[model samples]
Target: MIDTDRTAAITAVLDSLADAWARGDGDAYGAHFTEDATYITFVGTRYQGRDDIAGSHNTLFAKFLKDTKLAHEVLDVRFLGADAAVVTTRGDTYKGEHPKKLTKVQTYTFVRQDGHWLVAAFHNTQRKPLMEAISFRFAPETKPKAWPAQLLDSVS
Candidate 1:
């Protein structure tokens, strides 16, 4: 049986992250992660520890990411055990209108710590739609089961 309470708690963490990003609060954003968390950006920059994440984001929030808000849709959430979960989401950062479709895929690993859920690791990847469509067209088996067939067909 699924533990709905735990699931809700895990998702609440994600909500908090989005809220922090919306406010450009790097400290608040990093607080959702573990002290020794590892974060890898889509551009391949890797940050070690919560402090690194927070400090780097503070720089970003002040410059390149200024006024940006993050938007995301949860794709999947699977419990590894009672205390751990892996979540997949589609997300993007935008300054104005929310994106019609998020262009990046992100994976988050959450671990329960001292009765609170926190992200232990995170990886973000930018999706290349053309490359994905080409791959899927040649290898239909590579398509995700949850993806609608009509979408691929239209792309092909």
Candidate 2:
């Protein structure tokens, strides 16, 4: 089980990483990851190793991401063991004169190495609400919709 103190430390690392991205500091952003970490962008492009992550982010920050600010909400953190954890978060990027174009769910896997927590694998994917895509609607006064058993049974 992960102690409260250890959880806090891991949270701090994630917060710092977001802060660095908001500041357009790629070097600082990548510092929270391990040397052999794997990072996947929202578009599914993958960057391997700390150097690649930092380098790719540096180029992005210098261009389209120059004026962007990162906003993140940590949804959950679960410990895999004493030295490993998985964190789930929702994040948005804001830039001047532009609407919030990207809303992503990020999963970060962290491992304790040499007494410090570092991201081992990071994956970001766009958030799409399935309810909206379908014609289903729910209101406070309306009864809850029942799922079709066939659909659930098929998946099972």
Candidate 3:
């Protein structure tokens, strides 16, 4: 069974990651991963290692985005072992602009190493609400802006 403290720790890590991305703090964002972590984007592009991760962030942030909100609903968190966990979450990014493009639902897998929990793998998928929602209204509530908020947000 997962204790509250462990859960809090996990939450902290996830939050920091989001904060980093939202704030355009590449260092903070990359800090959440292991040295050789594997990151797979929603489009199937894979990047390995901290260097690649850092490079990706550098290239992304260098483009200049006014990063905004990153609100998510943590669907579930399950322990793979004493040092590993899988977190399933649904969320969307909102850029303060026009023609919204949102990608919902992201799954993250983290592993605790040497007393520190680091993300070992990350996989993001676009949420298909209408496909599962018989009552969901297909409405354009607002346009989405990829604000680069997928990086670290808050660790504690």
Candidate 4:
């Protein structure tokens, strides 16, 4: 059984990240990650270390991502051990109304460091509905059982 308190703590960290992004506070947003964290963006940009993450986000927030808000829903969380966990979430960045369906799937690897859970690595990938539909239709077994069927229904 998973420890409710630990799960809550980990979820809180994700919440904090979203909160920080909503405020466009790059430093606060990066604080949730470990000092040596690795972050891979949907566009394939790789950021190494918390400083790099914060610096790049500062630039993005000041320009491209200005005024954007992050929306995310946790899909699953699995513990690797007492001090490590992997969390999967669907998310998107929006300016006005929250997205009805998040377009990106993200995975975060979190580690307990100095009694606090911090993201050690993060990977984000944009979902391609058409491609998913084709794959699922051709090979039903390729579909992930945990994924909602609606994820590919739109393409069908």
Candidate 5:
């Protein structure tokens, strides 16, 4: 497949993340990563194991974005080396008549350990979002060539 096609496929994996989280399937959500995956949240929280990630999600699944019928918007996708890539996506967690907006810029490093792209590291943040409405940004001609310097280490 072409790079664009491959990119779309990779993005589909990310889309599933919201699905898993929305359904409150802790095991399914965590299964999307590599065994040694490292995750960093927008609040700078670090989770080393999938257990920690699941535990953390479970704590807020019923309260925040999980109940909000989450949606994602892709901003940019830059490939690093051969098996690494950084993705910037804007998302929203819509709750009861309110959507906790998140301009999530995530760096998803996927490694094809076997034949699937398993997430190695996922670092993301929650940017100030709009109201409960879905904000789909397409043909966005205003992204930076290089990501901001704040993406040095996993903030969490």
Candidate 6:
């Protein structure tokens, strides 16, 4: 059974996390994650435990990410059980220096602990461009041949 109340709570957690990131508040951002949480950045760097996640983010927020603005939207949330849920979010980061928008899809595994929802695991990956995303969904047999030779061979 899905609990709308729990889902709203989980969404609030994610919203708080994004707000903290935008404000460069590492402590507040880390508060949303559990003590043993695992965070994987879009660039594939893994941070284990809340302390490490907070520490690394603190450094970045003070330096490279100081002026970064973040916008996040909850794409979906699915309950695994009474105490567990999986959430998907779309995030866009804007920086004046970096004109190109950095968009990513973030998946979070949330678990209810001590009467509160906390992020247990998080993974962020870059979002594919519109055309690339659509093309990637094509069935293997329906995929376009990249080379002329391959096309000729397939026709024969």
Better of 1 and 4 by TM-score: 4
TM-score (C-alpha, index-matched) for candidate 5: 0.69
**Residue 6 CA displacement from its true place in model 6, Å:** 0.9
Q: TM-score, each model?
A: 0.91, 0.78, 0.73, 0.94, 0.69, 0.78
Candidate 3 lDDT, 33-107, residue by residue in tens: 999999887778899987788678766765744465456667668888789888877666566652243446678
* Model 2 Cα RMSD, 1 decimal: 7.4
Candidate 6 on 31-105: residue-level lDDT in tens?
888999999999999999999888888899999899686777776788997899998776767765433433677
lDDT of 1 by residue, 1-156 (tens): 777899889889998999999999999999999999999999999999999999999899999999999998887788998899999888999989999878888999999999999999999999788988888889978887775343344355
For each candidate, what is the lDDT?
Answer: 0.89, 0.78, 0.70, 0.91, 0.66, 0.79
- Residue pairs whose backbone atoms clash in candidate 5: 44-156, 68-94
A best-first ranking of the candidates according to their TM-score comes to 4, 1, 6, 2, 3, 5
- Error at 15, model 1, angstroms: 0.8
- Candidate 6 local Cα displacement, residue 44, angstroms: 0.5
User: Which has the higher TM-score value, candidate number 4 or candidate number 5?
Assistant: 4
Candidate 2 local lDDT, residue 16: 90
lDDT of 5 by residue, 3-121 (tens): 78658767888878878977877677888788888998878989987777777777767555455556776766767656666666666566555344444556677766666766888
Q: Which candidate is the best by TM-score?
A: 4
Worst 10 residues of 6 by lDDT: 147-156
Q: TM-score for candidate 2, please give it.
A: 0.78
Regions more than 4 Å wrong, model 3 = 64-66, 96-103, 133-156
CA lDDT of 98 in candidate 6? 37
- Residue 53 C-alpha lDDT in model 3: 84
Worst 10 residues of 2 by lDDT: 147-156
lDDT of 2 by residue, 78-111 (tens): 8987899988877778866434433577899999
